[model samples]
Target: MKAYLILEDGSMYEGKSVGADKNVVSEIVFNTSMTGYLEVLTDPSYAGQAVVMTYPLIGNYGVCYDDKESNRPWVDAFIVRELSEFASNFRNEDSVQNLLKSNNIPCISGIDTRDLTKRLREYGTMNGMIVCESSFDMAQITQRINEYRVKGVVKKTSTEKIYTLPGNKKRVVLMDFGAKKSIAKELQKRGCEVIVVPYDTCAADIINLRPDGIMLSNGPGDPKENTAIIKEIKKLYDTDIPIFAICLGHQLMALATGADTYKLKYGHRGGNHPVKDLETGRTYISSQNHGYAVDESTLDKNVCVPAFINVNDSTNEGLRYINKNIFTVQYHPEASPGPGDSSYLFDKFMKMMED
Candidate 1:
């Protein structure tokens, strides 16, 4: 069915609506990944937003049950330039259309996604609406987009209760603010006993678990919104246990360590970003998706800059404690739907645990 995408800034684009035939209003952001649409759709980090895939041809690899980052689709809606009609992978269990249809997530295809991406790149992320067969009144959609509320996304995506992933090696306590399961898999794969807790978990409660290490997890929203978590992290900072974080966790670490954070004009959301290690001058292609970044000036002078300069924009990418075992990356080291270039960071975490 024919559809119209109206932005809060009074911009409008027409396209064909696929999947669930319903209207959606969410923060519209574009991703540059050529693959992993399924992972993007299911990622809890995408919750409360509509995603526009910059890759022209999507769903060609088909959808597999095993590639899911979360239990279900968290995105408010999906936008694409093209939608594959046929499932084409060996492990294909279903078509992308069927998966979104089954999950009640709306998608609009056949739009000029590249142009949309360019616009977002220039104007920054905006509230947008995907309406099916509605009267093409840009004013109404724009007003609706302006009225939408955008807070509490992280709480909505986070697990309501604590859970555990058992292992026999080093005891690791993970604070899951909508963390990807791949993180636990990495820790467990390295023989760590993983205990996954909810977002509201306290520092004393975690320390009482007698863990050898603490893992702050990735999730949605600005890190400054998580005041309690920042306080919790502050309480844990003086402890002797090792700490590791990724993405949102990285932001929280910065907040805990007296660093400031600010949102990017249009955040990094792709697999091909290059990050350079400041000390060693080594570079690694990374997978990233977050709008906020830690302010380097807020970092302690004694602290070392392990990773620096995201090639797309020279922003901070990683941080390591001055004389401690705490470390974090602003990009995904687990690399669920992307490259494994930064995966060695997990091994380094294991080394810290072993020590």
Candidate 2:
């Protein structure tokens, strides 16, 4: 069926509907990754937003079960420049269309996704709607776009209750800030007994568990708004157990340590951000999302910044605790839907546990 996307700004693009026959409206954003579309679709971080793939041809390899970052697709909608019909990969068990159809997600293809990406870059991400071309109404579409809500995104995506993966190697407690399942899988792969707690779990409760380490997971929303978590992290700061964080987690860690964070006018929301490691002078291309970052100037007097700024935007990407076994990165080391350049951080966490 003929489909068209109507942005809040009244800009429209025509396309073909490839998945379920339904209208979808969401805050539209874009990703620059050339591959890993399945992982991107399934990641909880993309919840409540429609994702536009910058790469012209998508679904060339089809969808495979093993590539999922979460239990199911969380994105509100999917858009691409072209939709590959043929399933080419050896592990392909489901076509991309079938995958989205099964999940009841609305998808639009055969559009100028590059143009959409350009608009997002220029105007920052904004709410939009994918509708049947025959039913388009500018006023209704704009009203729907304005009504889109991206708040409380973490709660909508997080697990309803506690869950556990059995392991005895090391007890790791993860604060679920809309965490992807891959984070749990990574800990399980390391033989760590992973206990995933709710985002609002008290510091005393976590300490009572006597975990070998604690992990602050990536989530949606401004880090400064989560005041309780900041207070909680402060109580754990002096603990001897190793503490590691990622993305939003990293921002919260900085806040908990008396640092401040600020929102970017046009935030980093793509997969190709380049980050440098100040300790080793090594640079790695990283995947990132979120609109706010810790202000390096507000760091504690003795605190040290371990990660250099993103080369393109000069935003903070990593930090370390002075004389303490604590650190965090403003990128995805689990990298369920992007490059694995920073995966070594996982091994570093393991080594920290050993020490």
Candidate 3:
């Protein structure tokens, strides 16, 4: 069936429907990763966005149940240049198209993804609609696109109740703002008892648990919009407990510390971004997926210092709080579907708790 990806700016790309035949309206963004399409699809951070895979060919390796970052795909829609006809991986359990269909997510294939990416790069990400109907009114579609906004995505994706994972070592309370499964997996692997809580959990309740440390998790949406959560995080910061955060959590931590954040032009959503450690002068390839970054100029120099920066864009990647056992990073250290170079940050957090 014929499908069309219509941008809010009136730009359209015609293609063939490869997944469910339903229509979808959401913010459209692009990912530069060549592999791990399944991981990207299931990542809760992409909750309100329709993802466009920049790497021409997708699903060549097929889907595996074990590779999922979440229980189900959260992306509103998927776009690809070409959908592979064959699933050839030894660990393959189901085809990509079948996965999307089962999740009721719509997808479009055989489109000029390169040109689409170029337009997004020049014009920035925009609200878009994926129309799979036989016939549709363009006027109505454009109206919906202009009125659409991605809000409350964190609450929609976060766990509603607190859950515990028993372990014999340190006790850590993980504030789950639509966290990836690997974040808890990494803590469990370190022998820590992980207690995953909802995003809106109060600091007093977390302190009552008497955890050895706290972990602020990654999630979706603009950081500045989470004003209530930021206030709660500031209360958490008042205590001396060690804290480690990633992605959205990083931005929130900065905001809690009197810093500000700004949206990037196109945002970084690739697995091969290079970040440099300011303290050691070492550079490492990191996996990133955020649209907003902490503004270094707005940070309080007396309270925190920039720890790491993106080499390509000179954006803040990591920060260290002075005289406090708190630190955060804007990239994924768990590396569920990317390189493991930054995985050592997890160990550093463990050491901080030990001290």
Evaluated with TM-score, which candidate comes out highest?
Answer: 3
Q: Rank the candidates by lDDT, best first.
A: 3, 1, 2
Pairs that clash in candidate 1 = none
The segments of candidate 2 whose C-alpha lies over 4 angstroms from its true place after superposition are 304-306
Scored by lDDT, the top model is: 3
* Candidate 1 lDDT tens digits, 37-117: 888888888877899999999988889989888889889999999998987779999899998999998889989998899
Q: What is the TM-score (0 to 1) of candidate 1? A: 0.96
Give the Cα lDDT of each candidate.
Answer: 0.86, 0.85, 0.95
Which residues of candidate 3, in runs, are more than 4 Å off?
none
Instruction: Give RMSD to native, each candidate.
Output: 1.4, 1.9, 0.8
Clashes of each: 0, 0, 0
What digit string (tens of lDDT, one per residue) describes model 3 on residues 1-355?
9999999899999999999999999999999998889999999999999999999999999999999999999999999999997999899999999999999999999999999999999999999999998789999999999999889989988999999998999999999998999999999999999999999999999999999999999999998889999999999999999999999999999999999999898899988999999999999999989999999999999999999999998999999999999999999999777899999998999999999
What TM-score would every model get versus the actual structure?
Answer: 0.96, 0.93, 0.99
lDDT of 2 by residue, 51-161 (tens): 888889998899898988778898889999889999798999898899899999999998998778888889877889989668666787788889987777777776777
Q: How far out, in Å, is residue 84 in model 1?
A: 0.7
User: lDDT score, residue 93, model 1?
Assistant: 92
